[model samples]
Target chain A: MAEVRVENVSRSFGAHKALDDVSIAFPDGGFYALLGPSGSGKTTLLRQIAGFDFPDSGRIVIDGKGVERVPVEKRRIGMVFQNYALFPNMSVTDNVAFGLSVRGVSRAEIAGEVQRALDLVQLGGLGERRPHQLSGGQRQRVALARAIVIRPQVLLLDEPLSALDKALRVDMQVELKRIQREVGITTIFVTHDQEEALTMSDRIGILREGRLVQEGSPEEIYDHPVSEFAATFLGDANILRGEATETGIRLGDGTEIATRLNSMVRMTGKVSCAVRPERITILPASAAASTTGNRLAGRVSKRIFAGDSSTYFVERDGQTIKVLVQNAGQIPFDEGQDIVLTWSPESTVLIRT
Target chain B: MTSAQAARKGIRPALPLLAPAYLWLTVAIFLPLSAMAFFSFMTDLPMAGREWSLTLKNYAAFFSTSLYLTLLWSSLRLGLEVTAWCLVIGFPAAYVLAKVLKGRAREAIFLLVILPFWSNGLVRIFSWAMVLREGGILDTALNAVLPFTVSIDLMYSYPAVIIGLVHSYVPYMVLTCYLTLQAIDDSLIEAARSLGASRRQVLRRLILPLAMPGIVAGAVLIFVPVVGSFMEPRILGGRTGTFYGTVIEDQFVAVFNWPLGAALSFILLAVVLLILAASAPILRRAQQ
Candidate 1:
């Protein structure tokens, strides 16, 4: 396993810059996720690390050695594509043994390694089948086995689980995490799905428009997104426009919300308040008077029961904000009913607009 | 009505839609072929403008003649060579056209590749004759720099026939291979590269295997035409122009032996069918 370091990498096609001055270092034996939407340079970055593409202006080092001149095969990086591009002509055993065979390993060793790789992916007895005979999940596992069988320095997966159905995707995600841990290979997984990134990654690097917007643990990304884009992209957030003052910012409806601000930050500026849906609590009118912190009087515009939880669309000051309440008991309110939305000072994050 | 009767009624109304093309094929193709087969079994008229009789003399004569057998073998050999050459040159050109060029550039290149086929075959052969003859354009171009005499007589030879056949059939081979290569998903190569296969490995393992169907189809197309071709060898092969096609033409024109010509034509058809049948299983396996 090798640590991968990308320094000031930039790539462009004509006028469209796919990656621009992006730099990141992945430590040895950790799962790093490059999380971003489509056209956000996640795949480009992964391809560069795999030595499939060269950066226009930067250097990449694997295990403290510069790999700019090394060819893809010599770099010894294994990659799993999104489509699980297994060789249709080869059986599963031959597909997994392709790398070893190309590198001139002995036939006896190849047979043993192929079987071990197949067994690692939970497909011990399926070496004779073609890719078309396998399901989407099975094909993806075959692709994974083929990638890791040679014990590459780095393992790169470009949205590998995106092709499977939801149930299969979840199962494969758990399997992938287990396999990665077992192998202890430095892996870089590129995915746009926040849930997948959060679940599988040791550290998630959220990218936007070819730039790293935030890099942190899943909880940090969820609870402490530094920008409006980061907060909105990671999860649904109710954004309230406000202004910063000595005590707190005044909402558009002239309601004063008490908030704690960093002392270093100036108070004379426009700010936005972000709150998660589940963080806001809906209370009865009798309990509204006793509530503290930020409270707003609103009417339930729409209430939807989504199996395990009930979602309330509360309209406050001409803005509809969503509040998710667990369906442990009866719903707190019905559609078009008046209710008080309450949240603690800590729940509302003050972000610069 | 009964259910069976209702179903028969439903089927009866749509049968006319399939009739016209089948009738045309039967009358235009199968009927003539059957007539030719029947005539091949008949004896040729002893004198000009005479009548026909039931005899296997034509077939017997074709197998008995050493000259005719040699010509048949030579034609089949030339056909194989032309097909092999077309494939060797056409596959890479088609690959470049389909995978490297894009948009209007690809279309432009394809058009250029196919442009030779748009001209009449007689005109194309005459043009090649001009280039291959002594003191022709090719000789003149070579003589400009070389001190030695560049005018060698190249017009009437086996090489000339093979060259003409390849030139005529290369575009068809390229088109077949291009369509096959174009249909292959590029992601397959990308996947191979990401899996640590080099560029040469990608071409050998992914491209050649996937394009095998088109290669086989092109080979069949080029081989069938070159083997049965009379015009190229007649114009280009002067003394060496004694191919199976020339003999078939001779029986019809010079000898006025329709029965013998028909028998020779049937033999050639059988040879082509045999080759196709022999290759089908191999091609099918390659595709799988």
Candidate 2:
């Protein structure tokens, strides 16, 4: 039940800075996800928090104690690696008991606690089996059980479900969330998968090029992304670069898209606007004869039929605009059919850059 | 296909490929072993114009003679000591080469560790004689650094034999251990540390067990050969190196007791087999 606060942490490899002046405070008992692309320094920041690697500058405070210089063994952090890293020489029970055994727990108590941990992970009857004998998902659960056995102040997971297949990954994600809620440990998970981050974490910090570009709850971030990178990277967003006006941005084709966000932007300069794909509704031009909020007319270039939903790619002024619509029992708008795209002004996000 | 036909089909391609190697082993190993067994049961070598007969006398002689039994124990202890020293020195060297060093530096240093194996074993052992003999390199070096005269005579001693054997076989330990140690994932160590395992705990609980196969392989390679070794003991041990191996050598080279020597050799082979069988389960677990 400890909170981890990374303060002004900066680390560099030679002249290339991997993490630069990043500061973030994780609330106690919160499931936080450090989401980023490869080489974006999410793993580096996680390592700094875990004490696997030290930051060249700045302090790391865990549970109100500055421990940037402390080694991992003394920091009392449990970690589940990407590959699980279950000790091959040990059986499933032994792997789970490792942390407690290292802390000099009694044998009778270790056996009981190990069994309880295994039961907690729902691996009740698999004590004697080696790590190689278990399935990928089973190994992941054992890893989780092992990390929580000693009841560390904080738990770190480095791409915990990345090695599992799609179905198992989803299953494990739900299971992971349930276990973390049960333990109520301050857990920090690092991953490159955006869906995993969005679905599993209470709070997410999106990083880009060694800097924290955005940090908020999933709903907060999804509904309002400040930068163009966050807008496109977190989810599908249509971006239009044009001249800023009192209403919004005027496109090259003289189409003015209204943006509802207004706090931090220039009054009269070039600006960009972002609109999510799912927020827009597409209708055939023959049936689209209404004046509403933020309307645009374009020809449908392509339509993809996924089982429950279909994405329509519409071409408007040399740009392809993507719109996701739920599939009703009707044929989608055909190719070369003129369509009108409409979304409320609340769905439109104004980007400062 | 039916089960019998499928089994036949699987064997058809493999039999031809496996025949040459098995045939070579039968000719080179089994035939000689059979011949040695036959000679061990004989009272004398069936040389030209010599009387010979089958007897259990050589085996009886080995059991009845205390010198032979004592020397056998001595040779076994020598093998154990040498294997222990090799492991003590070699495992850390292997770990450094495999984990600590990286890139081309690892490759170059690993080659340097294995470079001695490229030279002749006899020459290497004899070179140790130069270092261990009275008033030799070691004595001279120690004397030059001290204010008093020093008599560092280590030649013709049991420790000299162990030193020479360890020098000749430590590379085997380093090579085998390096292969397995390098395959250990770096993340396992970090995972252990994250679970609050100290450095010694991680090494004992994770690394030593994981590298057990390589350690066993290196032990078998060094111990089996050192148990039957005559040259290393003779070259470096001189007079005090009168081990069971040297006694076996004497039967063929000096004593003219071929049947007895073959019987002794068979007994040593039995001891080596027993040691291997004792450690087989451990080796199997390490491999898994």
Candidate 3:
């Protein structure tokens, strides 16, 4: 268990830059997730930290020691690839024992360690089966067992749960978090799924075009996004683009939505106000007078029932905003009905575009 | 008849589609093999230039001759030697071609490997003869560099036969191995390395096991063809290069003893089949 610090790391393949001076630090015994879309250099950054790839510029340090010159085998980094990469020719026991055997561990020790690793992943007594004989989730667990059996300082996982179905993925996510907590190993998980990052990571580093855009806890990132990209990528947020004024930002429709001028808007000419769908409350036209705070007169454009919650698409001044209401025995409103939408000022975040 | 009954009475739908393939297989493959098997059991009439009667005398004559047994042993030894040599050289080359080369470079290298096969086998042997003969290219080149006169009669020898067979069959080994190597996922090797395996460990534990199928397949292909080859031993094998294939050729073409030749051919067939059967278990285990 060691802290991994990457400083100004950049990598390029010919003219196409894969990583652009990305830098982030993962503390010891914490789960750090590099979250981004495809081609966003999250995997590249993870590989660089794993010693599989060398940065063109800058340094990667683990526990205050430079690891750039270290070979992947010598780096002692445990990596679980997206494809699992289990040795298909070997049985599960042999696969898990590979790292220990390579390090010249005794046969008796290897047997005990292999069994322990298998049990850690809830796959005890499956050592005799080959990778092809296992299901996707089982194979991934085998891969995890193989990686963690070595007990390296840093555990690198590159989209390990991406191959499983939704239900299995959720189950495995919980299992992975439990294993990490039990072992207390410093783990870096690379993924594109926002929900997985939010659920599993102690700190989520959101990357965009090979750059580290934001790094914070899940709640911090989701509630206080510093940029429009970060806010939109984390989840669905209503972004109202407007030009800043002395009073408040004026919308394109000449309607001025009053807001407390934030430091971000003062520095940047353009600003975007983001509000979560659930934060916005919808009131009937007849009960519009009863609502308080930032209110907008709109008509319900669309209504959808999502089991426990109902979503209303409200249109105001040619802008469509989604409002989510919990199903608590309230009569559902019909589409095209007039309503007043209101939200608290604290829930709205001002972002610079 | 009613329309439905007429339709039912027509020819089977799949028969016409399969007819041409079955006809070709019978004419081109089965008929020749059946003739060869039939001739092995018959007594040859030299006067009539054909077989006279069915008999086991030909097979009996095979075990009775020590000279025939020696030649058969020589053929087996040469085939095994050539196959081993091809595997040693071709496996590494195939590994590089499959894992290292990419795009146009890979295609270019593959083409270079196959280019030699486009030329005739006899032509390649003749070219080797020019290099290996006394006062030939190799001898002349050695004489120029050394003070003593270097004259090695290498054109007709067991080594020459092995060399020729290896050269002829190496491309086949490389191609088969390359296909197998290409099918392996590269991430498996990376995973092995990240798991604390050294370079040698990775190759021995991961690569060699995965590539065993191709290696076995190449060995069988090279060994089978070299054992049955007549032209290489005749052209390159001198006094020491005499093999079972040449003796079988002599019985059929030179001495006009078709019964003895058929018997010798059957012995060769049995030997080859025995080898294949013996190696089948090893091949199956390697693949698994």
Which candidate number would show the highest TM-score if scored against the true structure? 2
For each prediction in turn, the share of the native Cα contacts (below 8 Å between chains A and B) that it retains comes to 0.62, 0.87, 0.83
Q: Candidate 3: global Cα-lDDT? A: 0.88
Global lDDT scores for all candidate models: 0.87, 0.91, 0.88
Tens-place lDDT digits, model 2, residues A61-176 = 99999999999999989899999999988999989999989899999999999999999999999999999999999999999999999998999999999999999999999999
Tell me how far candidate 2 lies from the true structure as C-alpha RMSD in angstroms: 2.2
Q: Give lDDT tens digits, candidate 2, residues B156-221.
A: 888899999999899999999999999999999999999999999999989998998899989999
Error of 2 at B22 (Å): 1.4
| Model 3 C-alpha lDDT per residue in residues B1-288, reported as the tens digit of each score | 797986897767768989999999999988977777777787865345653888998888877878788878878988889988999989889999999999999999899999889999899999888988888998999999999997986888777888888889999899989988998898998999899899999989988889888888888888887887898888888676678888888887999777678778878888899989987987888766
Clashes of each: 0, 0, 1
lDDT of 3 by residue, A39-68 (tens): 999999998888887999999999889998
Record all residue pairs in model 1 with backbone atoms less than 3 Å apart, i.e. clashing. none
Worst 10 residues of 1 chain B by lDDT: B43-52
In the range B1-288, model 1's lDDT, one tens digit per residue, is 898988878977766997898899999999989988988998764458967689988888877879888999999998989989999999999999989999999988989998997899999998989988888888888988798876766888878887888899999889999999998887777777766777888888788888888898888888887898899999988788779998899888999888899999999999889989987888888776
Candidate number of the best lDDT: 2
